[model samples]
Target: MRLYTIETGFFKLDGGAMFGVVPKSLWQRTNPADERNLCTWTNRLLLIEDGNQLILVDTAIGDKQDEKFFSHYFLHGDATLDGSLAKYGFHRDDITDVILTHLHFDHCGGAIKRDGERLLPAFKNARFWSNEKHWEWAINPNPREKASFLRDNILPIQESGQLHFIKDGEPFSPNIDIRYAYGHTESMMLPQICYQGKTILYMADLLPSVGHIPLPYVMGYDVRPLTTMEERQHYWQEIVDNEYILFLEHDPINACCTLQHTEKGVRLKETFRLEDMFG
Candidate 1:
């Protein structure tokens, strides 16, 4: 099996929102904010190539939104979904499966695209994979998360007849296993993979960056902040004990990292690019 890091580009978000209760004095040291108090973050996706299967983990925010809608996020960067795929000699049409971690706009927006007046599945030939629980929650989103779960970014896969759900205890692929966390959003699916004699856990919002390694650095966007803390406690220890590599989705600089049992609980042991490990 081979894994490739697909960088869709970067966008900015209020640093305060990204790092829940953590003070700017603390988080700014690591994720320094711009004059507007917004911190730039990368929308990094993962691609898996195994035998006859070519699977994409997540799609970053797409270009379908109006300029007024995008003005708030300040999306900037040269990399794009199609460009990143072509970098690995692959294309959206080459993807056989698309595993959505959650239906948040920034994560799943690229799954669909704007074609004239119709919104459609961006990967027409691929089966879009999402859990049943998340699927239901996103379609009928609560007020707290309604903005993040845009109907344009979702619903199209189901309408296109290409949506599939991963059942509990059911394996999606021989080398991949689905791990769920409810704090970030209902049943957010984290893809854990066994590759190159090491395990890589895709940290989708559960742990956005190395700066969020501390126990209290949960995102303000999380619906259940306390549950997020609990989930982090469990995963942090497990990652350290088993020496697992964490594949970060929104970290601006680091694509992957490892944790260790430090004097101050689990802390970042090392940070490096995914290509540094597999390329």
Candidate 2:
């Protein structure tokens, strides 16, 4: 099995929103903010190459949104979903499975594309995967998260008859297991992948960056901040115990990291690029 890091570009978000309840004085040290207090973040996706199945985890914000809608996020960078796939000598059509961590625009936007007036699946041949629980929550989103669950990024998959649901705790692939977390959004599935005698947990908003390893660094965007805290506590233990390599999704610089049980609590031990480990 081979894993590839797919760079879909970077965007800016309010640092205060990214680090919930945490003071800017603290979080800014790790994720420095701009003049407007917006921190730059990468929309990093993961590609799994195993046998004939090429599974992609989370599509970054696609280029379908109008200029007015995009101006708020400050989407800047040269990396794109299609370009990144081509970098690996692959294409959107080559993907057999597209696993959406959640229905958030940043994570699933690239799953669909705007074709003139109609929205369509970006990966024509890939079976898009999203859990039924999340699919329902996103479609009928609450006022707080309604903005993140853009219909243009989600509805087309089901409309195209290529959408499938993976049950919680089920194996999505021979070496990949699904684990659900409810804090970030209802039933956000994090893929636990086994590769080369090690396990790598795809940190899909669960732990957005190494800076978020601390228990109190939960994101303000989470629907249930306390639930997020509890989930982090539980997962951090497993992460430290198993020495799992955390594949960060939004970290602009670091791609993967490991944790150590420090006197205070679990903290980042080391950060490295994915190729450094897989190569």
Candidate 3:
């Protein structure tokens, strides 16, 4: 099995929103804010190459939104899905599965693309995987998260007849298992992979960055903040016990890290690039 960190691009978000109730003074030390109180974050995705299947974790924000819509988030960086895939000698067609962690625009936007005047599946041959509950929640989004679940990024896969869903607690691949959490969004599936003699958990929005290692540092966008605290407590314990790497999706600078017990509970131990671990 092989894993590649696919860099789609970087965008900005209000640091306060990303840090939840945590005060800007505290979070700014870790994720410094700009004049606009926005912090740049990486739209990092994961590509899993196991045997004959090439599964992509989350598709980063695609380039389909109009300039007015994109003006809100300052998108930067030269890395793109096509360029990253080509570097690995593959293309969108080579992806057999596109596992959306959730239907948030940043997480699933690249799953679809603009084709002439219509929206369509970006990966023509890939079976887009999103849990049934998440699919529904995204489609009928609540007022708070409605802005983030753009219909253009979703709807296309189902319309194209390429959408699929895995049962909760089900295994996604031989080496990967699904763990469901409701704090970030209903049925947010975090992929637990047994790779290189260690367990790695995709941090998704449940834990967006190493700075979010603190249990109370939940994102304000989460529908259930209290549930997030409980989930983080349990997840951090397991992370420390198993010495698992937390694969961050939005951390601008760091890619992966392990945790250890701290005076304040479990906390980030070491940060490293993905390739450094196995190289």
- State in Å the error of residue 89, model 1: 0.8
Query: CA shift at 271, candidate 2, in angstroms?
Result: 0.3
Q: Write candidate 2's Cα lDDT for 86-150 as tens digits.
A: 99999899999999999999999888888899999989999999999999999999999999999
Give the poorly placed runs of model 3, Cα more than 4 Å off. none
RMSD of 1: 0.7
Q: Alpha carbon lDDT of residue 190, candidate 1?
A: 93
TM-score: model 2 vs. ground truth: 0.99
Candidate 3 lDDT at 163 equals: 96
Task: Kindly give the stretch of ten consecutive residues in candidate 3 with the minimal lDDT sum.
Answer: 259-268
Local accuracy of candidate 1 as per-residue lDDT tens digits, 1-279: 899999988999999999998999999999999999999999999999989999999899988999998999999999988999999899899999999999999999999989999999999889999989999999999999999999988888899999999997787888999999999999999999999999999999999999999989999999999999999999888999999999999999999999998778889899998888877
Clashes of 3: 0
Against the hidden reference, what TM-scores do the models get?
Answer: 0.99, 0.99, 0.98
TM-score of predicted model 1? 0.99
Question: For residues 122-230, what per-residue lDDT tens digits would candidate 3 score against the true structure?
Answer: 9998999998899999899999989988888888889999999999867998899989889989999899989989888998998888889888999999999999999
